[model samples]
Target: MAFDGTCVACLVHELKEQLLNGRIAKIAQPETDELLLTIKSTSGQKRLCISASASLPLIYLTDSNKPSPMTAPNFCMLLRKHISNGRIVDIYQPKLERIIHFTIEHLDELGDLCKKDLIVEIMGKHSNIIFCNENGMIIDSIKHVSAQMSSVREVLPGRDYFVPDTMEKSDPLSVSESDFIELLIKRNMTLAKSLYTSFTGVSPVAAEEICTLSGIDSYLSPKELSGDTFKHLYNQFTIYFSAVKEGRFSPAIYYDGKEPKEFSALPLTHFGGYTRKEFSSISEVLETYYASKNTITRIRQKSADLRHIVQTALDRNKKKYDLQLKQLKDTENRDKYKVYGELLHTYGYNLEPGAKKLEALNYYTNEMITIPLDHTKTPQENAQRYFDKYNKQKRTFEALSKLIQETQDDITYLESISNALDIALTEDDLAEIKEELINAGYMRRKFTKKKIKIKNKPLHYISSDGFHMYVGKNNLQNDELTFHFAVGNDWWFHAKGTPGSHVVVKTEGQELPDRTFEEAGRLAAYYSKARGSEKVEIDYIEKKHVKKPNGGKPGFVVYYTNYSLMIDSDISQIQELS
Candidate 1:
């Protein structure tokens, strides 16, 4: 679920309990769209982060502090001057909308206690943190929205502050069953759309959950539902809303395998097949889910250039490979042409001049065959022409075979680089990959005189059996780990016939346990493109037997003798060395 009205309501409930009488101690604007407020309550000091980022609008309690600028912004200064020491009189959500109103009691210039409302709206692009008087007139906002910016409402100072009721949605907590059924019937859209359009703060995920709970197809229109079905659906809505009203919030994140799919302020029974991880507070759930999501998002953003380069090259090479394969197939008849020339020379010694055709016996197949000849040339001349044609095609076949092999190698190298980017967690990892691309001639080197000093290293993990296993993140690391770092007795592991990391288990002149071997194989599979597979085939060989061919691509190796194993790609239980 999104950080919808229900999520905000949960946060409001938590805030009302934890920070009802808290006094504002400090305030700061660390980013253009974010505000950090420190409040001193009866328990202790607490940090509340309010962000109105157009991409990710969020509000949550955090323990971390962001560094503020040397000079404060005008809005931050205004907040400090007006409500730096204001007591939080009340905190509430408005009709299940994605908005929170914090009513603060503050002392005015005349020493009289006055009330003010600091509103935080969590709408996507229209999100804002606004300061207003008790009369609901906006004093200022973190983001100034003028008449030109929005036709719905203006968030500038002196503007009337109100929750823009553009949707005209009813409060789900108070709506009757008949009204719910009627609202659904009024909408011609799907059942999911009707649920969100008819009620405030119910996201598509929540709507889908309602439909799933009621045993109705979310894609089906409300007009298709029977009266009994509508009643059952409304009953499910009441039960879901009752949990919200009764404060039975279960902050949880649903995971598809190892990746977080979605999070909700309440238990999502519809996500039964997915892994559900519940936290004690909604803040924790939001923080954990977003932190993981942000890390993955940032890595993808950083690796976009690398991915584009690899994918473009891969496509070109694959096309070239296909064309080369066709040319090679065309040359498959070169052997037949050679046999034709030989048979024609033997069978046409006494033929008439410019013989158009000849009958010959195929010595290999022991069968009679017909050979066509050029009418303008003599029998011997026609045989020589056939030989020349055969030689040309034979040369083509040889050249194309090598070209095809090289093209395949190019595709494999790019794919390995792509797989490396998937596991690249730091800028150092990306730097190493970029350097490898430069060295491999995929990317041109800049005109800088100084050489790059690489700081990235292989991932080191201690197996369950206490054997040290190292996994390379990219081709450069793979070469370094296998050739320079590992000893002759050390074991090397790789995903069989695929682009993957080179994994090395340090034997220390001692034999490795079965569990260590399995762990190392798992690492090889997890870092490869086959990470999502149920089981990946891995080949393991001693470092002495695994040899890199001269003039071959980086991380490319040949091992005639090796042990193979099928292992799953889960390495979560393996402990890594810092």
Candidate 2:
């Protein structure tokens, strides 16, 4: 997960734009380093995600993603005690320095209105989630930055705090063209490198985008820029700043084919062809991608043994078939030899039947051999016995042929089912697929006769355009959605060639708008194990082509001629169903 400071900036901007005046409805710390803030915005309730993890620290507004632990972590409990029901008074970013401050107003122990400042510094290793009193006295923090850790300032209790200094750099959002050029020249680097490194809060990618818009090479030396060139660059930078203020988010994922790719946008060229997606914010990207990945991982963890069981059965059967095939081949040689023996006995008198000094001609290979058989038996009797031997050998071949065919068929069937599992999306879908394995004797059935209590169907989301989308939780639910619930015109989607749940978008005979398709694709991609991947391939097709074989595993199906899209594994755009 690329939980960079840029992602944190995007989240802060989103909260200020879409959820500025929203009240803090609920707060929960589901993990040691994570917080889920449920806010009641004018549009609807939204969940904002914040984390101060040593591995990954970022703050983003997420629509749908799995919470970390079922039990609350200690940090979460501490946060709930200090900040519950705290109304957000203000949300501000500190000059694009990868930090966001939320001024929350609440009643103190004496029931008087008190204000607390929650500062989120998203500076990678320096990231901290701090809670302070109105006087800037540190109350508690997700992480404590002691004096020993940093020369700047301590984040311990009772310390008077202030935001970190940006040293000598001018704020990119407000600096004059001459100042910008002066800072760039002092850096003595490429235009892309200079702007990102010199400016307070200017990401390398965003800086390069400015150069791109101005028709200037990002690799050009900053010292080579003329006065007019500097002015042109500044104007382009301003355009982007204004665009961000207007909420124009270009959500994207960079990858090399099937694997996720990561790079700092500071060197824009390194982030090649980062396809802009249909998402509105970074949180949407995190939610969809991570949630899908979580589901896939969970199912894989749960069904690890079932997969092993089926594979073991397959290996055992394959070996049996190989041995039987070899035996059949050897029997053919034995039968032919027996026939040769009988022929030699019957035709011995015509050749050199019992004469040790004479060799008889071999009928099959034209080799000469001395025939020693019953002396009283005529050549005619021996010939009749050879014919009988030939007939018996042919019968054995016929018997073994049927057995070999059955074993090969079994191998083919089991392999097909395993391939279907690779594309399963949800645990329920896996459950359905597992049933098929059990029924075929590849696995043992545990819930043979117990009545299964059906939970409510997976959460449903209605798009802004009013299209209904249904997400399946497991294979049994997938079967229900595709076969019994969905209409013919409904669109079906799944993570291409991976285990994931089926996502169905009901058009209701209504033609799907393009946004709806992208949104649905994002959901499908997000719900698979590949969700955090740079690009998760999604398979989309009309509901009509999907079919479950009789007694097939749950969520297993056969379909062809589907459209595929490479999408980022984030589903933050669609509002989750309550």
Candidate 3:
């Protein structure tokens, strides 16, 4: 979900309650587009994080602190010089806009009392944090926006700081029922579209919720609605905003299985089927949602180079493997050449002089066959020529068979590396994968005087039946968990004929329950390359039955006997230990 106007309002309410009279204790710029401000309020010291990132703009109160650079940025220095130790006079949001205003009071250079506004606009792409004087003149901004960037508003220093009037949206807090219906009826758009477009803070999801509450179709245009339906919609809209007006917010994140799907300032009836995890404050909701999203996004960004390397190698190996198979297919007729040579040796003496061909009965099949003859060559030479052709093809077949197997193995190893990348969640996981690639000669090993050690562990989970389960994140971890970690009596599970994590369940010499097996199977399926499939076929056996070849690649094993089960890739019910 977007950091919509309703979310902004909830944040403003929470901030006012926490930091209305707080003193600016410290200021730091940990990133180019972010700021961390420590404020000493009546409650306690709290850190407020505000980011104007073009991709993910956010403002939330967090307990965690980020390390700053040795030197402060220009914007941070300017802010510290002007508003250092300033008292937060008031904190408020303007109408339903996605903006927050922090009015600070402090003594100026002349020892006279003064006020300033630190405004944070949460607009996507155009988001900015501007410091303004009492007269609303921009002093400086975290990001400088020129006239060329946005003609509607320029956020450079000394420019007039005002909210852009391009939206021309009405404040939902004061919008009357008659005005709501009349304004919406003029627009030739869907009911949901008109609500968000007509009001300052109503988002598309919130508009849908209103329509659901009023028993109206959000897709229907306001112009097509009957008078009775419009009245009902207006009634529901007022009731919905009443929570915002009264500062009654229910912050929650809805989850689709284990993944966060959407977050809302108020309970969304439309998402009733989803698992809603409520929070005591809006900041908690924003922090949790964005933190989870950022972790996944950051890991992907960091793993891009590794992914590119793995994919390139995989593609090259796959093409080579295909060509090798085609070449191996051509060697199938080598046996036919051998038969021709044997037939020639038996019947060459019977050929006439200057004969172009020889017809002989193939004793093996009792069938007549014609053999082409080099007329200039003697019968002995012709027979030797056929024998030479057969010997060359026989040698070619032998070489190609070995080459094809090696190429096929290379393709498999590269694919497993690719799958490992897909499941990588941290830099440590990536480091382990990179080590594997370097060891396999796919990547060049870096020469360093001091060796850097990476400690990466497999995922641990507790099944419903109190059984301990472990899932490998990458090939290296898979090998460690399957061999060194598990005893002979422990159970092992893996996705059948696919690149995936090896799942191990420690039995401790007790009988296994069906529930534990199913849970472990889900983990094996979820961490594997076949994740998100409706059902995955899994092969399971005792650790004693799973044997790694003496020179096999990491995670490669042979199991002659195992049980197979079809299980889904859902691990939401499984409890994982961090």
Candidate 4:
């Protein structure tokens, strides 16, 4: 499914059909690697996307538009000067190599009708977009290739332009059976490996497709086939080769269950249809899946110290609260202890002057504390000291009890905030969570200037069945997605025990389906740190049950009555926005 030679061929065919006789209406560069050209034809208007990026070079008809920069790049301005209102003359592919050329006829500043060429080369690591004049003299390139970039070609202004030779490459559409067998044996590799590695135009997916058509194991060694077996294999190969010549192609995204494996052999998709190019590459799949993994890693690192602090505070608070409660309960017997000590001191005088024998008394305070008596001391002096000791102990208990309660409340507050952060889905949600820390005196508040406004949109995915699923990337977006966009009956999903994006499946009043549930699980898992794990637990429920708590951190919510399932976080299963 990667942007293979076949995709380049498709681009040539499309441009020939739509842009060859059309007039260029507008041009813009949406990204560094890409260009968008709006053309007007007798049929209607068409926008063509062209890219010469090493990683994702592509050319296709696209309906989606992007915001253009205020000032056009010099290259863009130059293209507009020479090619604006130009009529495309022809679309040509240089043999079967990864290059396409669009020749345009237009008037120059002197009003002479002249020819110009736009060449897009999509060879990985050597990809470039070159503009040349009528005589094939290089004008400039999107990327200037010098001796340092590539010795094979130098793309600079005023340089002569020519296509490089690729003699070792075999065109699968034109190869004879004898030539194929000889090449296969010469490569000394497996059939699939030879087909994939020896050819300049074929993708691994295409190699696999050829093997599938041949009814042979792609992994089988080239030397393993017998003469008769080779004959049968050649016959099958010829059939597929004829199909290629006839332009019989089917485009389907291959998947291992819920994950996208590749995209090729297609019933062609047009603009506004599912954009296979978005998930056509294995690298794209890896990037999306691992981005969520890195997010989880960052969250764990950020919260590690905070988690420990909360745990220690909680333990100390619990211990102090328990001790304080016990001390306060002892207050019931405080007066009793004081009365007993006083009675002993007062009654000592009656027993004998300066006598030490303690006598029992009816203590008004409930439980009693025994008092030590001295034979030499007067009763009044002992009684006075006893009262003072009782008052001091009582006051200390009251103060400790109030302080302990305050500590318990602080622990409770911190614990709640920690729980909210543990479920934060995006960096914006983390920002709101950190604000809580600042207000609670755990973080310092610097007089930071407010940030400039930028619109944040939800990450959107279109399901295989054509349902639109929206994932909120931050708490604000989550709130908007769930409370604003989601209907009561729409399904909501999130990763269990992990902070993740809110995934909403817009049911549009349709009954819930199993595939939809699985797709939602993939979204939930892919948006969480658990995305890289082989499997993750996902919780799902109706949108109605998901409630944003009052005064809670962004992306924080409480929901009950949900079901859970285990799923692999592989986004290779879901279709991403192009």
For candidate 2, the lDDT comes to: 0.70
lDDT of candidate 3 over 333-440, digit per residue (tens)? 777667777888888878888888889898999999888889998777887887888788789888988888888877777888888988888779999999998898
Task: Return the lDDT, model 2, position 186.
Answer: 89
Work out the TM-score per prediction. 0.70, 0.50, 0.85, 0.57
The residue-by-residue lDDT of candidate 4 on 1-578, one tens digit each, is: 55676655655654676667999999898656568899998768988767666655656666667667768887888899999999988888765577888899999999999999999887766778899998999998888888787787788999999987744777776777788788777887888888877665677766776777667898898888887777777786567545445655444454445444445543332212343443443233333433454356556655676567656766877887888778777776677558856686656556666665465655564444445656676677667666777887789777977787676656555555555456554555566656556655667777748652444467789888888899876556677899999989999998887667789999999986788788889989988757688889999999988998776555667897899999888777578783
Number of the predicted model whose lDDT against the real structure is largest: 3
Q: Encode model 2's per-residue lDDT on 212-323: one tens digit a residue.
A: 8788999999889888888888787777666545545566555555444433322344355663233555666665555555456556655677678768878988999998
Off by over 4 Å in 1: 10-95, 99-166, 172-198, 202-281, 445-454, 575-578
Alpha-carbon RMSD, candidate 4: 11.7
Question: Which ten contiguous residues of candidate 1 have the minimum total lDDT?
Answer: 292-301
Ranking by TM-score: 3, 1, 4, 2
Candidate 2 steric clashes? 23
Error of 2 at 465 (Å): 22
RMSD of each: 7.0, 10.8, 3.9, 11.7
1-578: candidate 1 lDDT, tens digit per residue = 57888898888888887789999999999877889999999989989989887767888888988779878999999999999899999999988999999999999989999999999999988899999999989999999999899898988999898777888899999998888888889998999999998899899999998888888999999999999898899999999899889888988889998778999987777899999998888888777878755546556767898888888889999999999998899998888888888887788887888678888899989999888988898887887888899999999999999899899999999999989988998768988988888888788888867676878789999998888899999998899999999999999999998999999999999989999999999999999989979999999999999998999898898989999999999987889897
> By lDDT, is 1 or 4 better?
1
- Candidate closer to the true structure by TM-score (higher is better), 1 or 4: 1
Clashing pairs in 4: 1-263, 250-265, 250-266, 250-267, 251-265, 251-266, 251-267, 258-573, 259-573, 260-572
* Model 4 worst lDDT window (10 residues): 266-275
